[model samples]
Target: MKLILVVVLTTAIAAIGITLSLILSQRQAARDRALSIISGNKLQDATGKPSDKNDPNKRRAALARKLKESEQEEKDDKKKKEKGKSTMRELIQQAGFDFPVSYYYILSIVSAAAFTIGAFSLGFPRIVIAMISIIGFFGFPRLVLFLLTKRRQKKFLEDFADALEAMMRLLKAGMPMNEAVKMCAKEFEGPIGEEMSRIYELQKIGTPLGEAAVLVAKRMPIPEMRMFATGLLIQQQTGSSLSDILGNLAKVIRSRFQLKRKVKALSAEAKSSAGIIAAMPPLVALGLNTFNPGYIDIIFETRSGHIGLACFGLWMFTGMVIMWKMSNFKV
Candidate 1:
């Protein structure tokens, strides 16, 4: 009877605690909602205020000024949207693989399926089959995608200087900034042009220029594009000459590109030496295995062999990372 009473008491205490927790959570949620509503109202009040006037001539002048400001604001907005659209397109292209998260899930499923099949078909050890599946389905695909994305981005950066020069020439010819961008989109081929074309279209369809530029900057993941977008946004806000600003930007970009090339050239020998040194160990191990099978088999035929292999892989990876860091230069 006493034990039953204790159990009942425990259950009641837990239920009370749970109920209190739920009540507190509900109160917190309500408070958050109220705060959100208050903030939203403040934003609407600031952005949606109405213009007021008392006299006819004054009203006319006020209306004209308001209209002009609205038009300029609209143009700025269109440019921003165009920039955004272009950026998203560039990111997709440069990454070389769409839907990385989805790809990982797919690869996981594929690896599991391959592992199951290998275990059943060849009578391989479960661990070996698992390793094979992991390497073939997940590891190899990830490696390939990484390499491809890197190469694609490199190509885009290499081409960026020329594209900027072309746009600068068009700007010098007294073409409007938007028109010059469109001309570049039409003239250049590849990722840069493709991104520019998207921006051009977005600007044409009434997207805000500032918003478009922000979008483009976000998508490209390039420092130069980000810098350009920021400069353009500031210029638009301050009513600066777009052509002269872009010309100076073009010069800066060109100089940076040249500097990057020089850095790469200077580091090429060190990079090459690192690669050769990294390869030597593996090649020497292979030669030893080929020349003396029994001697090599002793190390690789036991659990200790697996441990050694894992250690070797770790060492190699660490070395490669260090070498890459040494070689990499930012401008």
Candidate 2:
């Protein structure tokens, strides 16, 4: 039994050693292959040229040519990217109306049509139905558009500060201004990066940097962005260091973002109060109608009651509008 155990131990040890040796050999072979590729010592099989076979210098020269071709392909790709960007900017310009106007018109038309249909179907009083249509067509859609624009602008502003910081880092890393901008556009998501990408494209297509910057500012309609773009334009024209300019711009944007956040925090309570006040009347009425339908029905039982309800609705609307305006603070 002792002799058998000793033979088994020896066999297992030998097997383990062989496996380790194989692994080491494989790793060494991989390393050698990689080093050969890096040193341009590896060559394709030479069937056509007898002199090229086994020639290290020929292999190195072939590798050099391959590298040059790869570099040219990279340059071509960059040019194509720039061209695509310029085309998109041109399309945006050709669309003519800004987003806000386009959104407002479409919403207003839809709202007007809906209200007209609803009014006719419900046999609502002529005056009340007319007021509804008028509000839907003229007032409500504009309000919706204004709210959406403000929200979108706020989101863009928040994103812009971070994008600026990213651009600063890329600039510090020795990237050119346009390349840094392109990197930011590619790395970040949403409107801020999207707008910068558009500008980068425009610059590639021979649009003066200043003109492209101005166009971006106009499209965004943000003061901070306008200032940033103007700074870039001036830097480009005057041969200033873009890295330092971008760094400073990044700092300023972050400060503005901090200040805006502080303002929003301070205004939170007032905004909540306005929202609650605006919402309370409708919610309380809803509860009363649900719990005591007979009590609420008296208001609609008489002609005078109908007139009172209409006036009350107008008053409630006015109050809500006032509250909404008071709560809105531009950052």
Candidate 3:
């Protein structure tokens, strides 16, 4: 048990240290790349004689600046929306739950009570039981919420392009944007259907189509969803062809989905290795306790041993989180 604890702690600390170093290195590399790009652009501009209004370099610089401005505006908009809503409410909405936030509180209370009772029945020490209860109350519910939100988002993304194509076909059939959205709400199922229904409902309640799209984007907060909303907003403002915009957006989404799959496939081996490495210490300890009697008693019987075990578990959790973040690609 002692050996297992030490191994887990050492591995976790080392993994965390490595993760931090990699993050710092990546940031520094990004900064260097940005600086290099800026310097290269400046050098090219200096070497070239001032050209007419059709200068490609100037056009490129202006485009880049506009892109940056648009990105900053999007960021500010997201921040404002986030700030206006409660985090828990947003999480619940993302998880597809329509219950009030009070339900979450009730669920947490029940979880904490159940955990406390189970720990007591198992003969755990008071401090250990308290820690478990606290985790049940706070950590477990949030973890569940995160998992649900992620699963819902993944499902939405998987079917999103298809939804867009459906909507595009409706538009091409001479249906107005509102009718197309309403048809999508009825035609699809799962996250896409639910979100489309929401948008349709908002529109029915006298909300502008653009505002409804914005609200849907706010709820989902995914890039693809935002792109869809932006497309709607642009079409409304500029009188562009909605069918063409939806078709292009659908293509882009499909491309992004393909890239994500490729990245996940490439990272599968690393993720599997991390999972195995993380499970080994606990499995070894369980084996020792089962086959070699009293091998883990020290960890349960002594306060100092218990503290060490807790620290070991905490670090192990930290390491797993860091590894998960490392393996996950935002694209």
Residue-wise C-alpha lDDT for candidate 3, range 1-331, written one tens digit per residue: 7886687668767867878887787667744543343333211123365334425455455535544654686688678677865778878898999899999999999999998999999999999999999999999999999999999999999999999999899888888888888888898899999999999999999998877987887679787886677556655644445787788789878987998999999999989988998999999999998999997899999987877787778778877877876887656
Structural similarity to truth (TM-score) of each candidate: 0.61, 0.55, 0.72
RMSD of 3: 7.6
Candidate 1: tens digits of C-alpha lDDT, residues 242-264: 66556666777777779889999
Q: What lDDT would each prediction earn against the true structure?
A: 0.64, 0.66, 0.79
lDDT of 2 by residue, 130-213 (tens): 998998898875565566656667778888878877877887788877887788889877777678889899989989776787
Instruction: Please give the lDDT score at residue 193 for candidate 1.
Output: 81
TM-score, model 2 to reference = 0.55
Q: Which candidate, 1 or 3, would have the higher lDDT against the true structure?
A: 3
Q: Rank the candidates by lDDT, best first.
A: 3, 2, 1
lDDT comparing candidate 2 with the true structure: 0.66
Which candidate should be chosen as best, given TM-score against the real structure?
Answer: 3
Q: After TM-score superposition, what is the CA distance of residue 330 in candidate 3 from its true location, in Å?
A: 2.3
- Model 3 residue runs over 4 Å out of place are 1-85, 293-322
